[model samples]
Target: MNNKPYQRSELIYKDKIKKIKDSNIIIFGLGGVGSVAAESISRNFIKNLTIVDYDIYEVSNLNRQLYSNYDNIGKKKVDVLKENIKKHCKDTNIVARGEKVTDSNIEGFFNINYDYVIDAVDDVKAKLAIIKYCRDNNIPVVSCMGTGNRINPQMLTIDDIFKTFNCPLAKKMRKELKRLGILSLDTVFSKEKPVETVDKKLGSTSFVPGSAGLLLASYVINKIAFEE
Candidate 1:
């Protein structure tokens, strides 16, 4: 059967396979956008990854979180993400932490060294901490803003954090970061008002956090893979 060393050819091109080999990436959240972002990056075959989150999968997370599933309920998002990535890309290195990122643990969390830092956390304080740390270290970073509402994924755009407007989260972040003298940073936010309903919930079922996470992932991949 066609055994002319054909299978060996597949191995030869292995080295030529363009991947994020040897690059270090840290994602600081494992929720809706963060979980999906982590999964998307892992699929790119990044060499090293560090995911930090203290939350666990819950039924509510199934709505937008990438790693949410009935069987994974109560399991830490970092652990679940790690398992899923290993199943897909065994060659990639991963480090998962079941702890929140804060001022006290920020240094320890990022002390491992990294090429890029992705801020996916929902908490304003934590987001600020990560951004400050990344800026101080001169590491490339991309943050995500309100993805809770908005049905049109096309509305999501990446821009300097200070340039973002309309979105509530971005407005708050801009004010806080500006007060701290952090003028500009990359972020994914919508220019339109996020879709809110009469119920006043953060978002509706159709327009939710997934798109925001995907946008964040796209920015990160572009920055890391293409070095843009």
Candidate 2:
């Protein structure tokens, strides 16, 4: 019997694991950031997770998306991510919705009780909807802005979403949120120049997305386990 006592040792860090396990987290968009964030959070021993995404793994996604693989190219991003989580931690409670985040589904999608939300979608419209809903509900959320174009992952930083200037996506989000009377929120964004694609390829070659995703996950886990 492989009685390594994974469950018992987990109790040694019970207080910490309890804090994370008890919290409910929703991750939107299973793109570069979303995919990586999901993997990072799973390793942190979070008990409950809800992942939302309407995308499937593409050949291009193999570059940065954690769930992308040559064999799973056409698989839904959420499905693969959920499977990966289960493989790592079989006891984890995972709820996956293979649908896009939009105004129509936002309410029902986020209706479940969530302690925190991680915004990893690339679409500005979807990101705005998520931010607004979370802000209104006072649910803590960390959004990723513009991980598309950047080579240096070290330049990524977590800051007040409103304070993220010079980032093209952040600039747009700032204006939109300001118009909605929302002052600030948390975000992971890089100060490095946006990564450019020569032929408008489908995914990013830079390390920014993976780094930003890990950073976002780190912030959420820290807040849930220690700061809370």
Which candidate number would show the highest lDDT if scored against the true structure?
Answer: 2
Q: Which stretches of candidate 1 lie over 4 Å from their true place?
A: 1-19, 204-208
Model 2: per-residue lDDT, tens digit, 22-118? 7788899888888888888877656688899998888877888886889999988888888888986777789999987788779998766888899
lDDT of 1: 0.79
User: lDDT score of model 2?
Assistant: 0.82
Candidate 1 displacement at residue 182 in angstroms: 0.6
* lDDT of every predicted structure (CA atoms): 0.79, 0.82
Work out the TM-score per prediction. Answer: 0.87, 0.90
Q: Give the least accurate 10-residue stretch of model 2, judged by summed lDDT.
A: 2-11
Tens-digit lDDT string for candidate 1 (95-191): 9989877877788887667878889888999999899888888888889988776777777888998888878889899999988899899998888
